[model samples]
Target chain A: MSTEELQAWLRRFAELVHEHKDELTALDSAIGDADHGANLDRGMTAVLAALEEAPPADAAALLKKTGATLVSKVGGASGPLYGTLFLRMAGADTFPAALRAGYEGVLARGKAEPGDKTMVDALGPACDALDAGRSVAEAAQAAAEGRDATVPLVARKGRASYLGERSAGHADPGATSTALLLQAAAETLS
Target chain B: MTVGIVVVSHSRALADAAVELARQMLPGRELVVEVAAGTEDGGLGTDAMAVSAAIEAADGGEGTVVLMDLGSAVLSAETALEFLPDDVRERTTLSAAPLVEGLVGAVVVAAGGATREQVAAEAGRGLAPKEAQLR
Candidate 1:
């Protein structure tokens, strides 16, 4: 992705996050600490301000700045996990490759697998779809499906794991946000 | 060299209070310590960047042992290690001990000029007393 596309994708993500903040927080309240929405919204707003204050020269620079901003500003689990994702995406050769690397970064940082009912649920399928030569729009659709699939999963990782069986009914908040990320990517980076 | 202790917690009040309680274990001696807790605005969260800063501040050129409350605090501490200098990162240890009790034990041990491993080991032993009493 070019610098402009990366910037657009993050901006779109911030917008989607703002639009769905309550829904995300509501989902989190069902099984998490109820701060995912607020934390991410705060972080993204900082990212926007940082980007405006110092526009990055390239895709790598943009991703690095975004990652660093999130790590410093989010102040939650999402901060390091999502921050690592963007940081790992900096040097990849293609959008799909960058996303795949980001998925791996999340995996390494969060240590959550597909069925663990985290962002990996949505991001994993989206990465697979993109790797299989699917359109960015199709990958976004796959991410939405993955997010929907989380409604029945018993979270085995993250703070939701504390609820054990009770965590099954709610769609994973991380998955929901991951779907929004892919959707934003489809809109801007594609 | 005295091992330094840095507490990473979701609440600034909690970390500050816990450190207050822990430091009571060492009366006159110096216990190199730092707190990397809460958001910049004092919300309930953990900032990796702040954590990175705390680790640097806590390091007395000997070593640092980071104790986290749980969850994201641990993740933040781990992420902070990535930003440290190679020498500091190699000497730093992330203790998997319970926050409050562990801080108490760690502070005492670190005040005695313990090694990094010994400080971490003392922190891990924080629950032993409670466990023993319960048993």
Candidate 2:
């Protein structure tokens, strides 16, 4: 895929977030703070508005703009964490390398471990699969499996952590989202 | 060639919602946007490993960009970097823009075929103030 294609994919993803804002919030209500949907929706809405006014010239510039926007608009942990990912990716030169670097930035900022019932569980395995020469489809499948694997784990972070062992047996909304991301990638690649 | 995007966040619901919103806005755009969200699973908040994997998979020959939603998600993504090859690492870009502005910037750039630098710069622009206020 070309850099341009990658950018389009990101735009589509933002739109999807806007479309299902309500549903996502509802999911969060099950085991986390209800603001998940609302927060992301608001953030994406702002993103769309910015894009409408002026588009960037390159992938790095585009992502940099996005990072700045998120830092200013989004609150809580999500803002800085997400913002950092874009900032790092923008610094990168190519899509694959940028992704690899971006993931590293996420790990440095978020401080989460694998099997923690976090998106990391799915993401870590997926990266590993890709490294192993697996196709994007295969990697995505692994991500899905990783997401489902969270069902039996307990919550160790965020509001869900408050539930402690009670968090177990519940599918993590974040992991599920990660699975969707992989699916989207697969679709685009195909 | 089509491309894919990944939106990362602390909450899975938030990530899902972001994806849904993207779908609604650009129904005609030939791109795919995915979500990589962290859950309150017992181990940690967000899963860097999962996020890294998603990014790797999203990578078409052109590569992919990752947008994250705070805390451990970022940390996990960073950790996952070790697993990526140098070539893939070279293509990736990460930023710290506001979530909404960043998402929009990325989409617009992607749709328009802008470069990574351009997208990052736009994201830096953040949300504009109300027009009326400017006057």
Candidate 3:
């Protein structure tokens, strides 16, 4: 996607996060520190403001700035995790490449594999769909499915992991947020 | 200038308190101790940019050693390193120790003109006293 389209995607993601802030926080309360929604909302708001203050010259610069803003504002595990995704994705030239790079970045930062009941659970499937030449819409659906799949698996990463078997039955909050992000991309980028 | 120390935590008050406690541990000794904690709004969280700035500010020509409170605090500290200049990054280290204990140990050692490596070692051993006392 072009820089303009990417910026649109980011704005859409922020809107979605703001709209679902309470829901996201509720989900986090089940398995995390219950601040994901407020944290992401604050970060996204700052990102939008930053974008307006000093517009990025290119897609890479845009993503890099977004990453830095999130890292500085989000103030939790999600900060570094999501920050790394966009920062690494800035290096890619294609949508699929960007998704792959983003996923790899999360892995490096979080050290969580697929089925860990973390964001990787959703991000992994979305990247897979994108790699298979599926449309962004399809990738977004895959991400949602991946998030749903987390409900049955015990968490092995993040705070949810501390719950052990009790982590099962609750949807992974990070995975749910990942789906929101990919779905935003599908709606805006496409 | 001796080696510097940075304390990272999810709470600003906790970081500040830890620094205060460490300073008390080394009264009359002047050592560079920086704090990077909480979100911009002073809520519970960790900020990598703040951590990076704290590390830079803490640096007194000697290298800096960082001690973090929890999981994400560690991650933020690592991310902070990426924002540091290459020369500063090369000298910085993240100590694998508990926060309060480690900072007190690190500050005491650094106040004595210890090297970064030596400060880090003392911080890593900070938990040993408690462990021994429990035994």
Candidate 4:
């Protein structure tokens, strides 16, 4: 997708979060601090406000704004990890390359690996799929599958890790959200 | 009422999810919200080009505020500033607020065409804790 199209994808994703804040919070309650939904909701809300005040001049600035907001407000591992991801991606010039670079930044900053039952499990594969020249639709499908794949793996990072083996049964909230993002990208680009 | 909102997240899915939620919230509103998402796999976060374009789009008439998720995002955003034209950059404001609250609040205000000052005030408000209990 072109950079403009990619921006639409992000807008769509934010809309989804608003719609499902309660559900996401509920899911997070099971294995996390029970604030995932609320936290994300709150964060996005601020993002919307920030945009209204001073709209950025380009895609990189927008993403950078997002990353900083999350880090400063979220107040958890997600804040830093996700923040770094955007910060890095904001530096890239293309969709695919930015996607790959963003993923790598998340991985490096979060210090999580594939199969650790973290969001990485889903994200890792999705990046690979996109890198393989898969269509946005195909890549999004892969991302959904990757999110689902998190169900059986053991949590080794973030709050899910606190559950240990018990975390195996539940889907990672981050991963589920990741899938939704890919879906938005596909929809907007398509 | 022309307002711009930005979504930032580590997971593309998460950012996309937020966007979807926003669409549902104001189905008929002619608001402009943007997403700056991180990669799915282990790579860097958000695309600079995407963020820059979104900012440029927001600069049409109403100004914009850039919201981000974390440290690196803030840093990268600082770097991306170079890509924007002086005028557009002058109209843009960057904040470090909570993602969810900031985004939702901004959507509501921006959709209503709140002034830049009003929007910044709302964005600042998002940094505070929410009163709702986590169910």
Tell me the tens digit of each residue's lDDT in model 2 across A132-180. 7777788789988998899899878766788888878767766665666
Model 1 local distance difference test score: 0.92
Give the winner by lDDT: 1
Q: How much of the true A–B contact set does each candidate keep?
A: 0.65, 0.08, 0.65, 0.02
Q: lDDT for each of the candidates?
A: 0.92, 0.65, 0.90, 0.69
**Number of backbone collisions per candidate:** 0, 147, 0, 112
Which parts of model 3 are misplaced by more than 4 Å? Answer: none
Better of 1 and 3 by lDDT: 1
Q: Could you report the DockQ of all the candidates, in the order they appear?
A: 0.80, 0.05, 0.77, 0.03
Task: Give the winner by TM-score.
Answer: 1
Which lDDT tens digits does candidate 4 get at residues A2-75?
Answer: 44665677678778777877877776777776766666656666666676688777888888887766654553
Residue B94 in model 1: lDDT:
94
Structural similarity to truth (TM-score) of each candidate: 0.98, 0.55, 0.98, 0.57
Better of 1 and 3 by DockQ: 1
State in Å the error of residue A107, model 4.
0.7
Model 1, span A1-190: residue lDDT tens: 7788888999999999999999999999999999999999999999999999998988899998999899889988999999999999997979999999989998998888889999999999999999999999999999999999999999998799999999999999999999999999999976
Residue A28 of candidate 4: its Cα lDDT? 73
User: Judged by DockQ, which candidate is best?
Assistant: 1
Residue B33, model 1, lDDT: 87
